[model samples]
Target chain A: MQLFRGLSGFSLTPTDAEGRVQADLLGRLLQRIQAAGVDSLGLLGSTGGYAYLALAERQRAVRAAVEAVGGQMPIIVGVGALRTDEALALARDARKAGADGLLLAPVSYTPLTQEEAFQHIAAVAEAGELPLCIYNNPGTTKFIFGEDLIARLALVPNIAAIKMPLPADGDFAGELARLRARTPDGFAIGYSGDWGAAEALLAGGDAWYSVVAGLLPVPALKLLRAAQAGDAAEVRRLDAAFQPLWHLFREFGSFRVMYVIAELLGLCQLEPPRPILPLAGEVRPRVEAALQGL
Target chain B: MQLFRGLSGFSLTPTDAEGRVQADLLGRLLQRIQAAGVDSLGLLGSTGGYAYLALAERQRAVRAAVEAVGGQMPIIVGVGALRTDEALALARDARKAGADGLLLAPVSYTPLTQEEAFQHIAAVAEAGELPLCIYNNPGTTKFIFGEDLIARLALVPNIAAIKMPLPADGDFAGELARLRARTPDGFAIGYSGDWGAAEALLAGGDAWYSVVAGLLPVPALKLLRAAQAGDAAEVRRLDAAFQPLWHLFREFGSFRVMYVIAELLGLCQLEPPRPILPLAGEVRPRVEAALQGL
Candidate 1:
């Protein structure tokens, strides 16, 4: 199964002002990725704003996405919550809603000890009873995993993959080689930072767990394929085309910028939930221009 | 109003394994703070494990806390949530439950803009219709408040105080002076790092929003009183006795150590919710020793 490999497109979970999951709109979003033939659908990942949605809404999102394109591609649902039991409950909910795998980030209010994180991940992986990806997203989750911890987790049941942040050093080859040497055979390794995906993929990362592909899967897939084919020049051309949007993503946070991209694409007109404002002022036209030649 | 002044003792809201609030145990904890004659009670702050709770559970904690010590001392409730609307709801809930004031940390999943944080705080302040404290805890909230931003928030109606982490340089007097110059008159500026309370209080900070005061109110009160009286020698003596526990708090987060303290004090045996494990092994005897000299 290509469940944890290749280009995994992450879709946003659209919601009204009250934060209710707009299931139909979400279906529309998922359909684009399905038709684009991305390897998997990452429903309710960070881009999906799973952290903002309630459990029922998250389940609603998973159900809607599953019905939209369950068999067409593997559906990896993000099941991260601040509490262990909550994440476990979300894992079960996603599985029952027909999700194919789980993505768990150690979402924290209290900075966790290494032991706490290991126990939490292991317990969730056990209870989830589905293939899982350890979401090493320190930017949002604020829990940095030592390579030792990640290697240890790689040995746990159902813990089949990892989605890493862009390494600060940008030495993707060195990092990938190190991780690959430690993790088990066929344990997928993916990159999530959109700006770094080109290098990560070119360095032979197992997958590109992408935010842009959620909105622009065809172009993103083209870039991914170029990297897979070792066409560094072609990859650079496509990556250059994405540079402006990547700038916007880095500046405004891809979560906020994706909302603008959705509206610009004429796909949906929605704002992120409160405390995360949508981009206003000069950002819109920049987003329009960013999409002009893509 | 002394609502946001002097020593505000924070209390832990005990919960069962499923994250249900133990209202009676919470009330018992609050009564100790009240009986010790602390200036105010900070309910549902970080030590209370507020982030681990559901909105309904958080409201239940506030209502129980207010009922336990409503008129006896000012009850300042922590009303932080990931969503702005959720926080507004919590602010209103705290007010409806008879809380005297509100403390809001810019609790986030996505890192927020300064404008977003300002707008969120303002909206909650307006809706809460009560004095609120900016919980300037970058350590957990991961949202740093700039001096300019703090000055701007000081102008927001009903936003009356701030609870700061210990400054990186440990220059309490200099930081207090700078913030005091920027903020309006009578807007309280306090600190929460228990190890720094003596220095902070002696430096003329308006309050000490204390975690140790939550369970060990009597000794904490003595330390607060000595600092307030400008008795440097007495404050030093009191602070030294607290060194062992403060050492434990720094080594293991105070949230984990508090459970051990509670167990030793014969108050309650409840563990912190999962993902924040209890301190174990040699730590128990160390805690016992810390209390012996105190």
Candidate 2:
């Protein structure tokens, strides 16, 4: 499937203070992403605060997303959990609720062995019965995917793609080539760090699984398209406009800065689930300024 | 309180394939720790797989533990959760279920800011009402408590102690001195790395929050007593006997090793909740060998 190969815009699942998914608000956010003509919509991902939501709430978010923009674009749902059974259950719920694809993160409370993570991902991929993306987010999940593990996973049935972190050494071309050589044909490889996305796409990476695009899709799309066209100059120009926002994402964490972005953009104002506090009032001015050009 | 300042044994929670707590088996494990006269019972700490259990299951676990050993020793229940409100609710649940104290790790998916962690711990302390120990486990939770943050938490009401990871520099005396200087008179500080427990205690740590003590309480208790009595030779001798087990713990995580230890001792054999698979079949012989002379 080509579901994981383009500008996949992530969207937040608005929830009340008690974490019940605010379906209408979530629908509206999805509608925005669909209207902007992004390639896919990622629901219940890190930006959606999936880890903070209970299974019932996550199912509710998926159902709301499907109802809002089910056919408008490919709806890729994040089905990651600390428990493998929980992830499988979520994957079943997502497919039943009408999601078109799945993204599984190796979420663990205990730092997992690579073999354990491999089995967990393989189990979910087999159980999902939907194309799955390996969410290689070592930053939040803390389980780094070794090259051998990724190669092995790429061969697993229903495992279709990967969403990589920005390479520590910034060698996107080198990493992409190595992965491509091992992975079977048409296995999509994507990148997620909003700041490094342009370079990833320009380096011939297949997708940009974006967080900023959750709120501001047009600018992110412009950069993605420029990279796709192999116009490095145009991509850099668009990326420069995003530098200020990217700095805020890095400084305050993209997850927190995102709430501020949604509020400033007049979409909806909701605090992230607690234990992750909202950005301070003082940081709002900085967020406001970061939104200048875009 | 005195609850935070002694050998606190953490036990494995024997759960079935569905993760339902086996009350009788759990009670059997608790009895062993209690019979050995561990100063306190740390129910549902990391070694207990508290992260994998649902709140209802954790409540069942707390009730079972209290029934087994409530009047015999202080029960410090782990109330760590990804969400702040959930942790507060768990704290309330443990207290109502007859817990004598609380242990909280800043469990997070979105690696928490120090300010966020501080407010979270403070909120739980206020809601918990029982004396709470800060579970500063950066390895498990990935939320490193800055010295400044730990010092700040020490000043909060009802916050009684801290359970620390071993220092990279192995400077327990320096770290303990710095923490004690900032904390109030009796703000207890303990260490959890079982391999380092003897040294931590020998260097004057207030408690050894232990995992091996969950199964082999007799030998673990002996080590703790030696450390407490300032018998360096005896402490070293006992610690030497535990070296093979400690080596296994370092090779495989202590959490995974505990399950094998349970089976070897004729306790109920249970796999850790998956996606944490049981140790390889070959590793069992090594576990058997590690159990010698203890």
Candidate 3:
């Protein structure tokens, strides 16, 4: 199976006031994103607060997402953990829950070497028959996958694609070129920095792992459609309109700001997990202004 | 209780091949460190692989340390976790297991705001009667406690000393002076960068949170004793002697190298928890050379 390509929308795991996963609400949100023309549905992505959720809660989330999407689009479940055994267990559970593919990050409290990381992904891939997409967000994982490591990991069976963060130095075109040359064929390369989605898509990246798409799917789909059609002018026009929201994402992290935006749009009525409160103070006003502009 | 003051040795949590905590081995190791005259014992520290271990394993390690020490010295237990409720549970368990104090790090998969972190720590402190030491290891925790936040947290009742990493730029004296001026009286400040410990001690820092002290306690204690006596010449002499081990630490990280060194000395037979493998290949020779020099 083609694990993921084109525009993949990450769905937020809506929770009740007591911090339990509200699967019915989550299913509704997934239906909304799927209706907006996302190529795939990514549940329990970083935006979904997968790391913060317990194992049972995460399994429930996958079940709800699969039930909601109903095979209309591929459901990719995030199955990353701090240990190999835990990640393997999650991968098997995700497969059993009817997830189409698994998305994993090197979730760690301690730093991981390239060899250790390779072994970890290999073990998880072997645990289930589902394809896997490697999520490389160094900001959260604190472990960057260099071209050599990515190429090495691509050789492992069932390791299908990679979702990479935009280069901090703003060299998206160069980094994308390097990744294309380094990774083997049949391996899709995607970009996840929402602010750089347009540039990355224009540079021939396979997918935009979008946060905004989960909340405001219509606009996000429009931008992706423009990029896919090679209409640079239209892509720029839409990107310019989304600049205010992107600015908010840059100031406060996308994870926090995405919650506020979702709440404002009435897409979901749940708060972000603890230790990750919503935007407030000076940033809150700016987020409101950005949403109004959107 | 005063919690900790001069040299505090962080004990390693030894595990069997199946990754079960070997309490008997851990207890024996604690006894050796105490015999070396450490002022306090730190169980389940970063060196102790606290984040990698489950709650029950951590509790068992603490129980063993307390039993081994038998009130010979204070045993501070690390009780940090990704969730506030988990941290609170650990704090309460540590107290029940006869730990003298609690050590908390703002362990988060999602980044935490100052207000959220303050609330988390405050909740943990309120859950238990033991004193709390704020651990600020940005390398692992990824959240540094700025002066303003530290000052605010210091005001929280039962929040005692801070175990800080020496500044990466090697400005221990400058950072120590700033922390001293900002925090309130009686809030002891400790330093944890093993290489720069001598400089921090000379700067009038309250404690040395030593990783090496857990294994090679006599040498670690001698260096601390020299610094305490204001014997700059002896301190530098010992620092020079430990240079090889410090070099290994800089290259392969202290956590990985320390595990190898411990295994080499037969202090513990277990490897580091998953995602953090023991050192090998080209680095193994260098680590061996460093240990032989010691």
Candidate 4:
């Protein structure tokens, strides 16, 4: 069965005070997310701080999520790295750890050509044996997969989906339509920018690879359900309610803000890894207010 | 002694047909550039394909250059990586391999905050006793060190210079003046973007970290020497002569064009690492014509 559809909650990698992954905490968080009716779990996604953790810690997190879910929900692991060999190694590790699919982003210090990107995903797909979802978040990765490239990569047998960031101009409907026209049949297209998930899903995007869903799955699911049922009014209400949190995300990146939200909600007690500082100062009251509203 | 002044040639990592680093070829290339009167040798700079090579291979290349140069010219090694710990490791290895200085770029797959960038460089500076030159090529690194961040990083004890990309608008004089006013004295400001090297050097930049210099060192140094001697007429004349090559660099990236030039000159026989296709097809005759003119 395919691993991605509807809401795939991107789980946070909980860590102890010394910044080591706390597998038990991760397991518990996944359990809570599953209980809230989220469709799938995506471990080590950007919101999960996958880029910041070591290989062993990432492997531990993936293993913990798979154990916690116990096949009740599909587990997709983010397996992205700067080097193709490293990404291949991580893909293999994720598959061995029982992940249902791989979320691959073209990570680079030097810019990669479309040919390089295609070959990278093709290699990982050949190596991992699991379905792959190309994660295109150029805001962070600096590698944009244009429609032509996505169409080309879709020819690979194992590349089942793409999780894309919403265009900066907020043209969700137009962008979704363009992608649908370009991509082949059975190739699922999902939206990742949490703020745009409801509109994108309502406008016929296949899934929402969501950050908010990981921490507040019940509400996130409710919003997704509203979109699925074509209740545009309800979707609008939920999107409005989420505006405060979205504001925080727009100001200081979703990764850092998500850590603050998880800690604020008492879902996890881990600081974001070093180099990523915690949310502080004037933004704290606003975040607290948003959490209270939620 | 300072490893950078005038033209610091960004040497290519000569590789065999199988894509393995040919250390002997790399050594000979460095020697030829030294003979051309390049002020210093910058091995493993982006032009060297440092990002593409494995750690041991990078180490071997650095050691080979050090041995070949044999105190004939100072050697600066590029020690940049995705992770902070990995970068620190590479910096230490470069120092151990007898590199005279380190060229550090803030490499990231996930975008880094200014705080993270500063900390990464600070940690490397603490670990690697060799003098460090910050390499600010935002086009590739996806991490820009603004004037404020550059000022703060300059305060780090061992950061001696910066290799800055020429501004996109080609306002070399204006950018150089701005940097000179902000950074402290004794901080050598070098310019990359081979197209702008003559103007950058003439506008008070202390060095030119040049890709063209690595392959066509004789002519590159003549341009630099003219700029250094304040011969504006000669500088303009040389830059005019180099216009055709600059046009190719503008179309494709410097890394790819430089590979074509090096191969055309009979200095090396290596393709630009895979994913970076060699210059061919419609660009071939144009490149051939340019080489002939040079």
Interface-residue RMSD per candidate? 0.7, 0.7, 1.7, 3.1
lDDT per residue, candidate 2, A1-294, as tens digits? 349988999998899999899999999999999999899999988998999999999999999999999988999999999888899999988998999999999988889999999999999988889999999998899998999999999999999999999999999999999999999999999999999988899899999999998899998888998888899999999999999999988888999999988999999989999988999899998889989877
Question: How many residue pairs clash per model?
Answer: 0, 0, 0, 0
Question: Candidate 2, which segments miss by more than 4 Å at Cα?
Answer: none
RMSD of 4: 2.8
Runs of candidate 3 exceeding 4 Å displacement: A17-19, A281-289, A292-294, B281-289
Q: lDDT tens digits, residues B1-294, model 1?
A: 488889999888899999999999999999999999999999999999999999999999988988888999999999999999999999998999899999999989888889999999999999999999999998898898999999999999999999999999999999999999999998999999999999998899889999999999999999988888889999999999999999999999999999999999999998999988888868999999999989
Model 3 chain B TM at 0.96
Query: How many Å off is the CA of B133 in candidate 2?
Result: 0.6
The interface root mean square deviation of candidate 1 comes to 0.7
Q: Per-residue lDDT tens digits of candidate 4, residues B1-294? A: 447678898888987544578988888999999898788998988898888787788888988998899588889989887666678889999888888899998877557889888988888888899889999989888888888998898889999889998887878778777877877888888999888887788888889999988888988988988988899999999898899989988788788888777767777667776655676667767777887766
The CA lDDT at B273 in model 2 is 90
Which residue pairs does candidate 4 place in steric collision?
Answer: none
Model-by-model DockQ, in order: 0.87, 0.85, 0.63, 0.41
Please give each candidate's TM-score. 0.99, 0.99, 0.95, 0.91
| Residue A81 Cα positional deviation in candidate 4, in Å, after optimal superposition | 2.9
How accurate locally is residue B29 in candidate 2, as Cα lDDT from 0 to 100? 88
What lDDT is reached at residue A132 by model 3?
Answer: 93
**All models, RMSD in angstroms:** 0.8, 0.9, 2.1, 2.8
B1-294: candidate 2 lDDT, tens digit per residue: 359887999999999888899998899889889999899999999999999999899999999999998888899999999999899999999999999999999999888999999999999999999999999888888888898998899999999999999999999999999988889998999999999998899999999999998888899999989888899999999999999999999999999999998888888878999999999999999999989857
Estimate how well candidate 4 is docked, as a DockQ score.
0.41
